[model samples]
Target: MAEAPSWFGEVERAAWDRFRAEIPWLTEADRVLVEVASTLRARLATDPAMSVNAIAQLRMCLSAMGATPADRSRVDIPQNDDDPLTCYFN
Candidate 1:
């Protein structure tokens, strides 16, 4: 797994870890998007005063990455028979 950016706070680091865990199919090429999503999640967690638009944008980012159940259902990650967790994609 890629290391979280050094500037990431605890919340961001936690969010990064969760994304990496849940989106195991993500390649190094997806790192930027993951970082963006993690940063947005951390911002949302720490800033209750965030504007509705900002929240919506974060939700969009999460959805694009298949982080939500509905979005995940739309994704077709290939299953690796040797990896039990991959079976979840099937």
Candidate 2:
């Protein structure tokens, strides 16, 4: 199995933590979103070309769960100058 991009774990964990903290009562939709995020994280590990799309979806889930960053500076997803997949964000 292919390993995830270096920043994947950190980003995923942060989102998961935020979700747990913000949503004490999860609806069925919330549960589905969580499951989708987990599935996407694993799939993105093997198919990085889909990182942008996966990240977008994850962001939507986070936003829906009210887990968006309170301060933009505090959100640190990976940004690699050399990797086109990540450099776009920078």
* Tens-digit lDDT track of model 1 for 1-90: 578889888999999998888887777778888888888888888998988988888888888888789999988886758977775875
Q: Pick out the ten consecutive residues of candidate 1 with the lowest summed lDDT.
A: 78-87
What is residue 28's positional error in candidate 2, in angstroms?
A: 4.4
- Top of the candidates by lDDT: 1
> Candidate 2 at residue 78, lDDT?
38
Pairing residues by index, what is the TM-score of model 2?
0.40
Tens-digit lDDT track of model 2 for 2-58 = 222245466565544544545544455556576556556555655668767777986
Candidates in order have lDDT scores of 0.84, 0.56
Model 2 root mean square deviation, Cα atoms: 14.5
Alpha-carbon RMSD, each predicted model: 4.1, 14.5
In model 2, which runs have C-alpha deviations exceeding 4 angstroms?
A: 1-25, 45-47, 70-90
